[model samples]
Target: MTQLETAMAILMKTFDTYAAADGNKGSLSKGEAKTMLEKELPGLLKAAKNQAEVDKLLGGLDFNGDSEVDFSEFVVLVAALTCACHGRCKK
Candidate 1:
């Protein structure tokens, strides 16, 4: 697979791996989202100045107000972060 294809597959797999923890294979509950962020994006969490900032970030990701993050929402979060880090990661 191409690099983008592999990245997409990894995104799906990572989301599924976390979303399946509570038997909800389609979306992530708040706890699951927190766990996923804590484990998968520890640096991002650490960059937040406080717990409220991290909570706010996670809350903002739930665009539909459904209290759970679906795959599309998860993709938005990843895309936003990628954009935020785009130039910063360059050597």
Candidate 2:
């Protein structure tokens, strides 16, 4: 697989690994989501600087207001972070 394909696969695997913890294979419970972030994106949480920024970032992902994050929501978070990082580097 190409780099992008590998990255996507990793994302799927990571999301699955976290989501499976709560026995709800389709979406992550809040605890699952928190564990996923703490384990998979430690840097992101640190970079956030404060609780509000972290809250704002995570809050943005719940577009459907279901309180659980599905695969689409997980992917959007990664993509948004990537875009934010890329834009910063380009500046």
Candidate 3:
């Protein structure tokens, strides 16, 4: 697979791995999302100014107000982070 394809597969795998933690394979609960962020995106959390900011960011993930983050919502977070990081790198 090409690099982008490989990345996409990894993203799906990562989401599935975390989303399955609570036996709900369909989406990630709030706890699952927090754990995923803390474990997989440690740097992002560390960069946050405070715990409240991290909480705010996590709260924002449930875009549909469904109290869970599905694959599409998760992808939006990943894409936004990727764009931010890429922009930072080019500076």
lDDT of 2 by residue, 1-91 (tens): 9998999899999999999997899998877887888888899888878988867766677879998889999988888778887885342
* Model 3 collision count: 0
lDDT of 2 at 3: 100
Tens digit of lDDT per residue, candidate 3, span 1-91? 9999999999999999999999999899999999999999999999999999999998999999999999999999998888888885342
lDDT of 1 by residue, 1-91 (tens): 9999999999999999999999999999999999999999999988999999989988998999999999999999998889778865342
| Ten-residue stretch with the least lDDT total in model 1 | 82-91
Q: Model 3, poorest ten-residue lDDT window? A: 82-91
Ordered from best to worst lDDT, the candidate numbers read 3, 1, 2
**lDDT of residue 56 for candidate 2:** 75
Candidate 3, residue 34: lDDT: 99
What pairs collide in candidate 2? none
Each candidate's clash count: 0, 0, 0
Candidate numbers, best TM-score first, in rank order: 1, 3, 2
